[model samples]
Structures are given as C-alpha cells and as structure tokens.
Target: MAPSIQSLSMIHDSQECIKPIPAFSCCYLLRSCVRHASLYIGSTPDPARRLAQHNGDRYGAAKRTLRENLRPWEMVAIVSGFTSRVAALQFEWAWQNTKVSRHADLDGNATQELGVRICPRTAKEVKRVAKPRTSLTNILANLHLLLRSPYFSKWPIEVRFFSADVHRVWQVWLQRVDGLLNDGIRVVTDFAPDGISEVEGKELLAGAGRVGTLDVGYNSIKEYVEKSQFLLEDGERINCGVCKQRLILQHDIIAVCSHSSCHCAAHLSCLSSHFLKDKDSDSELVPREGTCPTCYSKLEWLTMMKEISLRLRGQAEVNRLFGRRQRAGTPKGQGLKSVRGRGHSEDENESDALQVSTGLDTVNLPPCSDGPWTIDCAIGVLGGIAHRPGGVSSGNDSDATVTPEIETHPQRCRRNQNTRTQRLGLQKSAMINLSDWYDAEVIE
Candidate 1:
C-alpha cells in the first residue's frame, strides 16, 4: 500500500532525529577577492561548504558576505582542534572582538585586574580609544596572542594555511612574536601549486577542483573504531589498564590503545589522569600523549578521543561494526528507532542518551601506579638495547648500555576542570546541531 504524505513526513522526522553527528569543528578565515582589505572570520563544522555559502552558491550566508561587491571570497586558512563547536564559537567571538576581550592583554593584567577595581571612564575617554582595525597583520597578531593565552595554549590546536602569501606573513610574525606557540600546537602550510592563477585558486576554493593537500598525521576515526571493535566483541571482561577495575561498557566512557597489537583498555577519566601525571601541571583535563600501560607504545590523546567519539555517536558505523542488518520490509527510520530502543544495548544508544541527559558519567577509578615501562625505556629497547634480568644491556658485552634519560622538562598541559563532563557536553551540543551542516544541499 502507498503511504500517505503525512506518514512520509513522520518517517523523515524520525530519520532526522536519529542521524549521527560528526565531532568536528574549525574556525576559518575568509578574504574578499574584490577588496583585499575586507576579511571575515567564522566557525563551522565543514569549511568547504561554508566557503560556498559565503560565495552566494548556497543559503545561510552571513549578511556581511552577501554583497555583490564582495561576490567571491577565498579561504586563507583554518584553525582546528577545538574540543567542541562551543569552544570554536568562543574563539571566533574572541578573535572578532580582540581589543575588548579579556584575552587581549599579554601581561595577564586583564584577567587578574578584574574585580580588583573599576575605574569609571568618561564618555570622551571611551570614545578616544579607536576600535582595532581588522587587517591581515592585526588578524595574525591576535591569533598568535590568543593561541598563547593560558586559556587556549594547552589545546592540541593546529593551524593550516592555504595561501602561500599568508603563510609567509605568518612565518615573519612568528619570529617577531614575543612568546612561542605551544609545542603541542602544529602549524601546517598547504598552499596551492606555484604559478596557479587567482581564478584557479577560486575554482579550488569553490570545490570544483582540489586546493592544497592536507597531511593527516593521525589515523582516521573510522579506521580506529573498526580496529577497536574486538574489545566489544571478545566477550572477555575488560578492565581499566590504569585502575585495574572492570570496565562497564554501558556506563563508563572507554579509551583503547591505538597500536594494533596492544589491547589496553581503560575508563576515559582513568587514562586522562594517568597521562597528566607525567607533566608538571595537574590542572589539565587533556594530555597530548602518553605511554600505554600494556604495550608501552606512545599514544596520542587526540587520536584516542577521536576513536571514542566514533564509538559514542557514529550510529551507521557502529551498526556495520556489529553486523546489525535491518529487517527486509522495515522502513529505514523504523529500523534505526528499533535498534536504539533495545535495553542493555550493543549499539550503546541508551548510554549515549544517558550521557546526553546527564553531563558526564564520572568513574571513580583508583589512582594509577607507576608503569613498569617508560617511553624512554621503550625507545631504548627499540634501539637494540635488550632487557636482561637485572637491567638493559647493549648489543656487545664490552659496550656499556647507557641508561636512557627520561624527559624532565615540564610540558604545558591542556587545562579544563572536568574531563568527561566537557567531552559529553561537546557531544550533546554537537549532536543537536548536526543537521545544520549536514542537511543543507550545496548547489554546486
């Protein structure tokens, strides 16, 4: 029987409700080709589509970029690695209003001076301070300052420059900047081929041609999630590698070792705390990298987080991983709805909902003990220093095996009060707005 129009609408709504949200957000820089001085800064989950919207090829473009005079726009660069869309938006707002933002002062005066005293300013005095002009120089300077700010310094952020001219300016500014960017933050240059004309660049930016090549440093979420699926399927009780406590699949957020041979598993909080111990700063909620407890392999915290994101929110991937096929006659929306309603779920649908409802599930795991192997020790072993009963020895008996020195320098840590709480908050907020980026159909 043919379904009614009302029935079709209901099914569509149901499908939209269950759509999986991607955990990605980035702040982008756009310049008006017509007027080189005119620039715009915005944030979005998808940069390519956002660029198209600004060029009048799609809907939902900001009023500022809609004028015929500024008909075409070019993306200069993008800053990614924000923990959430909210984080990216906060950054966007700060970048747009740098002069008044509390982050403007480099001396820590603004943050510390707040609530100490409020000297009233006259209308004339207020009017005397001109608004900071938005130029390429000022924009890059503010970006440098914001990245160094204590609030954002610890984040594993990466800056990618798509324009060769802009990248040269950035390089010059970095030398002039007072302080250096955090070691964890990466600066990438993905400029188009030399001798490419302005029109060619525009075509690339408009999605008609490939722009610059992106050098992805870590494993993608799909590959990471698929490889780690055995942890859920093995049926053996999994325990936290740090705390040595059994991991409850439905209750605790889990992180697995990225190394293919290693099967280390732990509560997200437990792993985070374990990684933070190596640094001088304990106030941080995220660690850039740490040695695995089981295999002693170095693991990137950002990579693990990406895998966790897929496990938590990627419904289609999860279904495929578990071999959960829909019944032949069932509607797609109905099939997804049924998959979500099962209790003690294999798909983690219930747990994801619970995490959304509550801020985050706090797991009270015991403090991590010192690991038997350190990263230095692992390096030494890989360098042909074999471990004997007492200590490590070199390849030759006559040669002395110098002990590998552990890193003592205090590395900066990414600070946030709560780990899981903020992560879950990101997931919840991102899921709600997933449709905004995904549902739109680009004209080109």
Candidate 2:
C-alpha cells in the first residue's frame, strides 16, 4: 500500500532511512488444550483478528486447523514488542526452524532462552527434563518474570505448596474423587520436576472461565523433591521416539502402542506431537486416529492416554512415599534406652523402668543401678557381711555370730563356722530349688 512497504518487499532500492511500519507485531501459539492437544504457530498483527481468520470467520480457516473440527480455540502464548511485522514473522520462522534462520542477529541459544520449543520428528532423548521451580536460581528468575508483568500490580498471585502426605501424593489408587466444586475447576497441580501435564493443564484451567483468580502453576508436587529412580532392570532398553534419548528413568513418560504387529514405544509428549502429524481423521472428536510411526498401526488416543496416565501414576509413586529410606528403628546391638527419649517419665530412671519391665527387679540389676530396696545389699548389711569388724567375708556370712568367748574355743568356733557355712549353703540350695519349682509349676 505504501512506497516503503513496496520497497521492502519488491523494490531493488536499498534506503537506510526508509523503515516499514513498526506498529504491527505479534507471535502466538494456537493449541488445543483438552482433547486434541494440537499446536499451531504463526505471527499476526492483531492476535484476536488473526484468530477469527483462523476460525473461518472471514474466509476458510487453515486446512489443518479446520480439518480437526475442535472449536473454541484459546491463544496459549503471545510474544509481542517486535520492531516491525517482518521482525515478528522472522521470529516465527526462527521458532519453527531453530537451525534454518540465516539472519545474523538470531542465535539458537537466544531462541531457546525465549521459550521457543522444538518438538523433534525423530528421537534423541527419553523425556524432556524440566527444571524444578523451587531451585533458588529458577525461583529468582521466575520472580523477575513475574515482577515484569503488569497484571500483578492489581491482582496478586499466591503460590501454596503442600508437603507429601504418603497416601495421596505418593500412591496410585483407583478411587474416584466423588464431587467437584461447581464454582471453579480445582486442579491437583503436581509440578514436580516436569510441569504438571506441561502447558495443557494450565491452559485448560485458565479457559475454565471461573470468575475468581486462578493459580496456574503446578499445585500438587512442589513442596517435595522425590529423588527416586527406575525400578526396572538394567538390561531393558527404553528410548524416547522423538528425542531418541534413553528412557531409563521411571519418571519418564513412556507411551507404547499395542497394535500386536507394531508395538511402537515413545515418550508420551513425543508421541503426542507425532499423533497430531500422523492423524488420518479430519474430525477432532474422533481421537486416537493417528498411525504408529514404526508399524503404521492406527493409534487410539484414548487407549494411549489411559495407558500413559496409568503408568505415570504407577511410576515411582511408591518410591516417592515408601521407597528405600533409613529405618526409624533403633540401631543394631545398641540397647534401647527409653528414658532419655522425649515424653519419658521424669520421676523414674529409664534403666530402672527397663529392668523392672524385664522381670529383673533388684537382684539382676548391676551395681550403680541397684534400687535402694534391693534385698542383696540390704541383707549384706544386716548379716554383718557389710559391717564385719576386720573385713567382710566373701561368702557364708549370713549365719556366723560374733562373741567374746566363742572366738577362743576352736572346736566351738569350728562347729559354729561349719553350722554357719551349712546354713548359708542350705539357704542358696533352697533358693535354687524354689526357682526350679516355680519354673516346673509354670511349665505344667
């Protein structure tokens, strides 16, 4: 329409001062959030206007987009602030072809840093390892991005993370969540390392049209870092069909198509993009119509999604909750002392309580632990063994008596000593007999 526009496109004249219109600029991703999960990318002057065109409001919509008949599309992301329409288009081109751009200003790292994702048609990886948002560096970077947005000035966003409760967050159960709140879609966001269902969940929840503000980040798994690994054998081979990387981890989303003849296995996200590309059905409602890349077998999305979800639910769930951890039991060979531990009785010593509980009241307890009422020590003092004049006799002092004349008479003394010794020996013999009798009675 203008001389400058014409010169930029067709005119041979290269003028330094002549600039194209800088007002037109925007790049967007049109993605099916819920069922189809198709992604389309392009640049436009007005996103809303271009969206209407894509929907066939003006002319026929894109053949690929309309072929799938899933209506009510939502703009997933829009990147603006380019200097001109040409710049925006170039950006789109860069996004679509990361290695093809010949422009001097464009770089692969820059494009990648801007969140321009490339879904490979072939394999080189198992799963796309996403960084955790809880990392300090990532948290600060996300914070910077959040602070840059103008929406936060008016309506603030709050992120709340819940610790893993072994039952819900870590285990796979078939029980259905009975009721859902009618007001808004309450999503369980487990953003862990890989974002919860990636971008699909966020877009779905946002498009729910709830009146109140919504938190789009992963809601279920941020509070904990489940440092777990694969439960499979080392001999088993697993690789992502898209990235071609080894799918060695349990956390990896491995999706396998069971077509009997063509059992094609791939990472879930990798197969998702492939599913869209290989889809034969023109209707989006007729899901799971894609062909397996390896076997050409028809891929049913419902079956694939079900299998993937079930596996992902099972993968490392038990490990996250009840996997190998240090046992809470007391260490081996070391005796358990209950009194020192918390909430123990302050009135009695723990050792005393232990001895009492084990049926080893006073006699069996070692020295420095004997109770004040122990019969062995009390009887020792009363029998003159502990209070002996010269020194305490090592044994048989319970019957011997001290007298002025009794010590002079050797025969009398010997008889008294023998009697004392006999009496002490009898007492010990009687004690053993009584114990045996009690044991025999109990056995009977």
Candidate 3:
C-alpha cells in the first residue's frame, strides 16, 4: 500500500533520507534576489556547506552577497558532469563574464548563459559590447580555426550558426557542409568529415549554452554581388591566389572563380596565367578553366566569365535577396524552398535563381535597437565625485578643468561607453522567453 501523505513527507524530508554530496566541486546558482526565487551563480563542491557559508551563524557571507544583506540563499540550479575543477572554474568564469566569452550569446536576445533569464519582467537585459570591424575572409579563417580547436571538444558549449534569417542560417550551414564534402574542401582543409569533432560531442554544443557563429560569408564581401554570382563587385583584397604575391599594381582586372558554391576571390588574370602554365587543355570552345587553387572547385573560363556578363551590370539589388518582414496577412510556409532546387547551374540562371529566391524570402527580420547597459561598465562619474583625486570641488569650482587623460583607463573607457549607450535608451525586441531558454522556442 502507498504510504500516507504525512508519512511520505516525513520520510522524504528527514535528515537521514538526504543523499551525501561530493566535496571539492560543482557550481550552483543561488536564487535569493527575488522575493520568491532570487538568482545568483556560484560554485562549490559541498552545497550543504556552501549554503551554511552564505548564511552562517558565525564567520561571514561571501563578498558578492555581503552588500545585499540577504540571508539564507536557496540553491536552485546545479551544474554537474565536469571532469575537472578547472573546467568548472572555466564555466563559472564564462557565465559571470558572459559578454566577453565566446560561449555566451550577445545577439541582443533576452537569453542568459545560465539558461534561465532572471526575472522575466524586471531583469535588465545586457546590451552588446562593440568590437572593431573585421574582413569576412579573416573572420572566417579565425572561425575555422576555433571550430577545429581541441577546446571545442573538451569545453561545454554549443556553436550556433546564424543568418540574417534563422531558417536560412540552417540552410547556409547545411550547404557549407555539403560543399565541403562534395567539392573535396575537406581534403585540403582540417574540416572534419562530419564537420564536428567526435570527442567534444554534446558538451561542445551543450544544449542551451550554445556559442553562436555567423554565416558571415555571404553578406560581408567588399562589394555586394547582386542577382548574379555570375558577376562580382570589386573585392577589397587581391593577391595572386596562385603565387600568394601582391598584384603588380591596382588596376588588374582580376578573373575570380565563378563557382556559386564557392566565392574564392583571386587575381582573375593571374588564375588564367596559372591555368595556361599548368598545360591544361585549351580551345575556343573549352578554354582552360583549371581548378581554383583556393577552394579546389572546378572552374571553366568560359562559364566563369561568361555566366557573369549575362547576369549583372551595376544594380542596387536592395530588397532583392534580402528576406522581407513577415506581414500579418501572409500565408504560412509561403516563402519556403528546397536547398537542392535552389542550387542553379549555368544553364538554369534566371529560373534557378527564382527557386533559390523563394526560400530566401523572409517575413520579419529582428528589429534593430539598442542593447542593455552593463551596470559594472556604467560610468559612476557623478556619484560622490567631489572627493575624487584632481577634482577640486572643495577648492574654487571655477578654476577646475578635467583633462581627457583622467579617463584613460581601458576599463573606464568601457564604462563610459556603456554609460553613454544607457543614456540613449535604444533596445531590440525578444524572440522568446529569456526566462527559460531551454524550454522556449522562438518562432517569428
């Protein structure tokens, strides 16, 4: 027979019924900030002892909570399954410093690294911290390196690929994977056969704690190649792709490879020279369009150059390939297409592009807005400023002048930037509940 409710409760809540916990490890979140479940992330091996440490009758509370004067913090989340203490420490560090960590999502989304966004209504979302702009080629190179890093396998994280549109993000990544396999890019580069390392497995992607990367490939070339992969706009970097030498001069009409699957930018004229040098078969009908030295995609000179001339000539092409904002009257799945049909050959130029266009059309792009201010980075210049060094409020106020040198610290500059952004009050909208990233599905 089932035990009575009173008897069951008594046994379950008894001290003897509690299981023993390990020592020397584990990070837990203490939810004490709210009246119900306040949130604070921390790590300790012995949760029982840690709880006692936070609210001990003797000794003192941790410095983080000493100011709050809140007692009896309850442990709500416990992260386990780390092989070593260093790994746990690494996780704690990333969680605390989410903005700088590669594992954190700073997409101006209302998500938290800890998996649960704090108080749904009261939590102040953090704004994105800016970094210097970089060339897409350089960025992709670095991303490729990190993807193959041993840390990607050992560390607990997820790598999410984003496009301007979420559905397209998945499509672009899959296409990249296929291109690498079918085009033999895997033979030259360190890309894995399946595209992910085996050892890292689930921990690397590690569920909701995914690290987001971009399909920054298509969007960031020097010039936008609209409507036609046939024609390319002027690119920023041009070295002899074959010799890796600087082009003799600036006005070289480069002959770039015309493979839509691979946008390998090279000195076009240099490529033709290399093709002829290789003793590749040459004729008027089938000119030597030798393989691209970089991506190894087969190239035919006639198709590479001819396909382009037939496609574009100085077009704005805005709102052409870009997904549109979804309107209320639109039908569901109205703009979807298969990735296979989307791949157009030189023969199917206009028609194939039309098919690709269907899937590319999106309804609503996430709105552009400001990010939440990082409070730690907030400038406290006016708070009790009278006694700060060099500030002579106590002396003659009229004679005081604060030079720019006073705010030279990199840390202070960050604080000032954050403060300035906070004063501006620009912010984006949310796709899902920041409160529970694990359970919430963001559909827009």
Best by TM-score: 1
Off by over 4 Å in 2: 1-20, 34-36, 103-444
Estimated TM-score for each candidate: 0.60, 0.23, 0.22
lDDT of 2 at 180: 20
lDDT of 3: 0.36
- Per-residue CA lDDT of candidate 2, range 126-197, in tens? 244333221112222232232233322111112212111111311111122122222111213222233555
Candidate 3 per-residue lDDT, tens place, 1-444, comes to 112456544633552433221112555555342232233556655555565566553355577655444554544334443334576677666555555767533542122222321122333322442221111211222233333333433333232231112223223333333122122112111121355543332223222112112121123322323423333444344466676765432333345655555555555556776676665545322233478887787775544443232222212222222432234332344223311222322331132232111111111222223322211111122221111322222333222222111102223223334433422321112222111112211221
What's the lDDT of the predicted structure labeled candidate 2?
0.37
lDDT of each: 0.60, 0.37, 0.36
Q: What ordering of candidates by TM-score runs from best to worst?
A: 1, 2, 3
TM-score of 2: 0.23
TM-score of 3: 0.22
Q: How big is the positional error of residue 27 in model 3, measured in Å on the Cα after superposition?
A: 1.1
Give one clash count per candidate, in the order shown. Answer: 0, 14, 19
C-alpha RMSD in Å of predicted model 1 compared with the true structure: 28.4
User: RMSD in Å for candidate 3, one decimal?
Assistant: 31.3
- Worst lDDT 10-window in candidate 3: 354-363
Model 2 RMSD in Å is 27.9
